[model samples]
Target: MNLNQLKISVRLVGAFIVVAMVGAALGLFAIFNMRTLNDADTDLYERETVGLALVKEANVQRYAAVVGLRDAVLATSAESRAAAIKRIEAGRAKSLELMAQARQKADDAESQAAYAKVDEAWKADQNALDEVLKLLAASEPMQDSPVLQHLRDVVAPPSIKVGMMMTELTQSQERRAQQVSDANTALYENSRNVMLALIVVGVVVGVGLGVVISRSVTRPLAVAVDSAERISKGDLMQPLQAQGKDETAVLLRALESMRGQLVEVVGRIRQGSQSVSLASAEIAQGNQ
Candidate 1:
């Protein structure tokens, strides 16, 4: 290609690079955004799992307290009402705390369900505690079969149900957390693969363009060298029809025209020298 054409090709290459840079930049931004979203999902899953675990722990403690209270009521010793009350209040506080935390999460479906169940369980516990405390405050028979039966009907059943609910919530939380981890891993892998592919493509395209440009630069120089070699072999009888309107083309044309003119001038000078020698010989013959 000529210089102007090569310059145009270079400009086109520059534009291609610019477009590639933009695309790469946009891809990079998308990767960053995906990572950000993945982090958010992961953080939310952790908090939710922690909240469910908290609720499960609180439920177990409360269930244990219920069993202990049942045993206490079955005894003839003084009622441990203060300790029972403390346990119930602590359980309530823990449930509320965990539920609140779970609700405060940004966008987790499973966590919200777990929190709902915990809230219902809290309400049930509150109602059950109220009834149990009232029954005990009336000094119901400590060892009576009827009172033990009544405790069986209310506190025991609710505790068992709440504990089961917490167990289910915990399992659900575990599954959801695992899913989030898997999704994040997949996203990271996909991003890495995509970026690697783009880089490979970029390198291949860049090398190909480099070869084309190098050829463009070298082709004219090669033609000029060949022209010089031909001139050195005394083969400039015909003018060179140079391809491009460049300095090299002008130089070769000038040298080729000079060769033709020099050949004509030498012919003229030889004819004049022969004419002079003939004139001198005629003069000498006339003198003789």
Candidate 2:
């Protein structure tokens, strides 16, 4: 169950695998965040930026139509009036097309409602314009005519209301864009913090694994070296505490066996010397 019981090669490979796993985890986390950020950027560009551009262009066309109507009303010549009427028709058509495109791009209920209000105001304005055109075709005098009064009171108000509604829609898009930008910023900060934390954790885990594996190999080797040195110096009294099924344990067992053999040989040599000394003393006493 001890780490040191495993082969040195296995322990080293296990440590490397652990470090690689940590690195892989960090890599996957980074990839996920990058994908999220890319999605956010795509949404901002496609929905917010493109939609805002469409709405602004539609508003410009609406203003052009209003200007053309004014010019038609104030024209002093028949040619100028016809040209003004042509401009009015072209502007109206273009504005309608642009607004339809903008409406198609409206994804949320609030934006759809705003577009509905704009359409209603545009319809009212168009009706008032039609009435004024009819009065002009009738060759009515504009000095104190009911047509001019109606144009001022009815046509102008709805056109202005349309402009106001468009302005509100534009503001809403701007606010939504700002919200998306702020969300992206917050997301980036959160991702940055999380990545840093992951990096720190990975580093700590790798270092810890390296230290543990290194000690498991080297600590036992140090013990083996010290035991060998003591045996070389004829200090055989100390016991080598070898525990495991590893090569180090085998080496320690061999050393312990060699030490026991050396102790037995030295004891036999001492006994033989004592026996020879006693024999020499007995011979000298017999000769005296």
Candidate 3:
């Protein structure tokens, strides 16, 4: 049905419902986009941020094991060597556990692969540390033993490789965090633009609807008012124009009916006055 054909109340109510629906849609849009951002934030914090910390902690534990191995080899007494050996084993175990934890936090395939490489490098370095500790436990001479000498030559490279792997893992986590942040930023910007567009469209539609309804209601009232003024001035010959099925149209038709009754009454008054004048002149001429 045509909007102008609708009653004033229905038009107003429909406009309100349309605006409300638009608002509800925009609200849901914002909520959905915000949920996406929240998920990204959670992943960045729980996986990338915390996982990077775990990898660094594991790296630190491995460094401590290296220090413990060095101390055990240089000790002169068996008791000192045994104590250092215990510390080295404890540190290595903690480092491996932390590495496992870090690997578990890996959220994506690339991060998991990076952690896998880190685990391999760590295992190789740990083996070297174990060999050095075993030699020290057996009372091998720290400076002259072949195993200790060989460890001295090869140990530094594996330790360095482990450090590199830790760096790689850290960089990977950082990159992942950056990607999440960048994606969220883009999403927020897009959502903002869409919301702005919706707001603009809503304003335009509301204004247009208001104008349409206002004109529909007022134009008919204006015509009724002008017709009423003409009838009050005794200009009853003009036809009334009542166009719609609204209340205003009913009022205009009622006014037209009243105008027709007034015309009949005035016509009767004019005919009665003419007859009285004719009767009075006929009586006066007969007296003369």
- List the RMSD of every prediction in angstroms: 8.5, 8.2, 8.4
* Most lDDT-accurate candidate: 2
Q: Give the per-residue lDDT of model 1 (tens digit) for 66-93.
A: 6655654564435445555565666556
- Clashes (N, CA, C under 3 Å) per candidate: 0, 0, 0
Better of 2 and 3 by TM-score: 3
Tell me the whole-model lDDT of each prediction, alpha carbons only. 0.66, 0.76, 0.75
Model 2 stretches astray by more than 4 angstroms: 1-58, 61-141, 241-288
Model 3: per-residue lDDT, tens digit, 118-167?
Answer: 77887788677667666666666344566665654677558757766876
Models ranked on lDDT: 2, 3, 1
Query: What local lDDT score does residue 8 receive in model 2, on the 0 to 100 scale?
Result: 65
Q: Which candidate, 1 or 3, has the higher TM-score? A: 3
What tens-digit string does per-residue lDDT give for candidate 2 at 116-161? 8988998999999999888776773335457766765678678767
TM-scores of all candidate predictions against the true structure: 0.49, 0.54, 0.55
How does model 3 fare in lDDT? 0.75
